[model samples]
Target: MSEPVDPAPRGGGVALCLPLDDEQRLDASARRHGVRVVARCSGASELAARIPALRPDAVVAAAQPQYLDAALVAACDEHGAKLVVVAITRDEQRLAAELGVIDTLAEPFEWDAQLEPAPGGPAPAAAADEPVAATPARGEVIAVWGPAGAPGRTSIAVALAAELAGRGGVVGLADADTHAAAIAPSLGLLDEAPGFAAACRLAGHDALTRDEFERVAEWVPLSRGGMSVLTGIGSASRWPELTAERVTATITAARAWVSTLVLDTAASLEHDEEISSDLHAPRRNAAALAAVRAADRVILVGAADAIGLTRLVRARLELLEHVPPERVIVVVNKVRASAIGVNPEAQVRQSLARFAGIDDPVLIPWDPRGFDAALLAGRPLGEAVPRSAARAALGALVDERILESAATRPGRRGFFTRERRLA
Candidate 1:
């Protein structure tokens, strides 16, 4: 065996997201490390935005909660660049591994170390026999979607969030609908700051801290404590701001902010812009698409009427194109004999099963009065009319869905774990 000497990395180009002082230190240490700093930036978002132009061989980013996240890793992979993260804590190192980094280095970095191991990359994990680290759990995201016509997506999402909040840890309700945004007005929230859009912006900059997220979100009081609310945009024109990248970043930032997240999304699922328009243009439905894809469970709500049933059938077929059928929780709302003919529950069930191949759909009986009270009170039906049959139905639906998943879902250390105090 011959001893190899002068091990330079695959390429000299490397992107660095560090302070100016550290940037200078890296410049001084590059020669010893056998790598060149191609570009130096202060934020992961900035580093990502420059990847295409810089075309670096590797990215070295600070392992802060916001800066070195899934979005940044994804951005690097999309550009075919390896990531070498600088982590200071056991949790951050765990996060780096979970994100599949090519290399991990301790902060303050031993740059003078003989650049050991592989030709270009730094060493991997610590020496063997180090105790395994447990990563904290992230909140599960649930997206409530429906077809074009009003099928009560917002109503269901609001109630679901409230119900989840009452059960335990902090819950988040995000109004992610691009067209006809309504969570703010429905909840009597002032929408003065446009919570969700602001959060998206902060996430893009890798500045979405726990305090910042809480500041942007309005607290909605429920029967048991309350949930944080990220009101929808004041108008649909701002859809482009919620890009797929930013949406992904926001969801990652939110993992520690709450135990459960409920997103009320738009109806349209068309992403045909790539074929019809410029490939690089901002997508209008990117927010909804991102939410649906990121969700642990998607609740497809359908108004139990003749016309609504037709739309649901078509929408479910389209939704299946994006997510697996098992990942979706089919829900038929406002079920009543007057709208869907005799035995509305049976009719709705049979229609869904026959047309969409959907079995075991939850049918919530019509309780207009309960919903009306909630609307007037600027609250969820569960909080406004806890004893209503509709609320009870929603409770059972959530219990079944969450419990079923909990039985099989992989467990992680509790960062935001809440006591199971179901109301």
Candidate 2:
């Protein structure tokens, strides 16, 4: 159907996808360094279109939304061209870097350095053909995520963390929700410290060691069956500070600090740049995406009612686009017969299977009294109301899914796969 374009040889061909002024400024450099501007494109689609014909060795574009996205990065990768971003601001630079651009130039550019060969010259391109598998983490990072209707993510996360901590190992609950963060208030902890954000900041600076991580994560009292807790920004406006890079780095470093980590993430997963063009703004949903992507498994929660289940089905489709189906463990919260009619669990399961193609989902029954009591007591369901149906349900999930036999789990790792869920 489509014609095949032969791969462009490595040369001084650079495609420019910049603003008019920037194009004028860099135009002179084309003549000086024997660099040729093979094509001029506007956005990602146009750039991709030109790639087949021009066969550029590199693409130079401003770090604005119009010039950058996953599509643009993919085009460069497919065409064997280096995507070099022209960034002026720190946010722009971070955005470009996160987009997987290895080469970048600040505004008021240079062609001599750009055209210069490496000190040892280029190695054989065949060296890059090697394939590698990532090592499994020594510890487990569980992300408790749900849609915006509030399907009880914090409660599930706290209960799950408590269940893991009950095994007499280090555990942590991190509030990665940037919107309406209530982990501190839910657990009766002080909220002024900006715990997780501070950790992200330290992670951004490469200063978050295990000790620093523990220090930033406040420890609960033994009376409450202690586990380390990292609070979130109490206000939603502070989301930008939790950049994807920092959140990812913090999550990576967390493997050594705790045996299990539970993260309560925000509902939004939209990549902001996809919606609106900007001068390289940080994504509002970066923390949630980063946590979900970084986690060993994601606990996708949704309320049992019609609206919640509807949202859940939509979330499942979006989530599966990012992670494999095996990485997801669906949970229907507040499962009551009154909400979803005669057979709530069956209805929920049927809906999921029909709409989202999910066969098995963990169903936690409605237990308002137990949750209210636990909330008032400022403790997890496991500690405050051990006999709660919700607590028992989540406990069972943690036990069966997370605390499997040691033989299957083996040693602490950064990445691994046995039969795991596949078994």
Candidate 3:
């Protein structure tokens, strides 16, 4: 008889609470490295209760100010758990240190590298030579981005989320457009609720934990289709400390609870100097760029008309430098079939291919009636008009691409391996 195979020995388990959607992917990766993971409460009090019972070897709190608060750090230390904080900006780094967190990870991290132990930390043990379990990459992050001049970034983003939600798996839409605060009104989300602004506040405080985030995020249901919406900040001025670190944390936490994360970003790509100097320059909009870089895929929105197409071509060139070509998707919005001249799809494709060399752009048909009605009612397109052409197009994309691709990615790496620098 064949000998029985022994189970792989798992290293000490770690408890993770983060604000970013990518936390799920990261957690899966950590398990691949033979480490066990324990998901704690989304609130601080519950987390405090679970800590002693779980006796985690380490604690990873992403971009939540409360997690790094002096009291929490002291609690972790008292319990003999190492704490690692993932920050988005230099200020967060300083704040983390002040709170006694010595380890950190930045956003847009390479999955493998980010999971590695902090500098000077001991390396993780190797996994059993057995094949790693297949796990999906984090949910798809679709960005509806267009240049200034009403290219319909927000409209497309909202509609796309509605379509995806209609198809079922949990979905979340975030308004990360710092320049334009339209998500609340566009979706008719009540400003009285603690939405994106509250999350940002938690992120800035250095005392926020994953549990805290879950408490503050508001869930807007889609009556027509599928998914939920996490509203964005009401104004740019309110997010002075809205660093990339905080955004990553918030997304990570959201991912643990949701299946899809859709971000509506500002048109501009310029970064604020005061926010943090760590970001690379010439790519101005650090926050939006960070979102794009972290996303599994990006959907570029362009107007159907002539000038819109022109801006799309130009923006494509700029994006090429930051994201891979295969990952960048071009979308032409407000297309009209009857509006004379050459075929709208063919002409737009030909123009983009000729100028920007991009092929196969997704074209969303004109649906002014459906869109206007939904906007006025403060509901998703799926809820307002389930049969709209625009909604169908979005569904096709989500089913064929987003969900399928995420389901097939390689399983996460389990063993943590920190970088080894040679003298």
Badly placed stretches (over 4 Å) of model 1 are 1-136, 272-276, 405-423
TM-score of 3: 0.60
Against the hidden reference, what TM-scores do the models get?
A: 0.64, 0.63, 0.60
Q: How accurate is candidate 2 locally (lDDT)?
A: 0.72
Report the number of clashing residue pairs per model.
0, 10, 37
Off by over 4 Å in 2: 1-137, 222-225, 406-423
RMSD vs true structure, all candidates: 16.2, 20.4, 13.8
Q: State the lDDT of candidate 2 residue by residue for 1-423, as single tens digits.
A: 112222442333567777767776676556554455666666766777656555555567777787777776766666666566665553454455455442234333456433434335342221122211111235578999988898999988888887766543356789999887889998999988879999999999999986687688877743323577999997788889899999999888877656578999999998888887884888888899999999989999999998999998889889987788899999999999999999888988888888888898999999999989989999888888888888889878976777655222211110111111010
lDDT of 3 at 396: 71
lDDT of each: 0.72, 0.72, 0.60
Error of 2 at 215 (Å): 1.5
Return the number of clashes found in candidate 3: 37
When sorted by TM-score, best at the front, the candidate numbers are 1, 2, 3
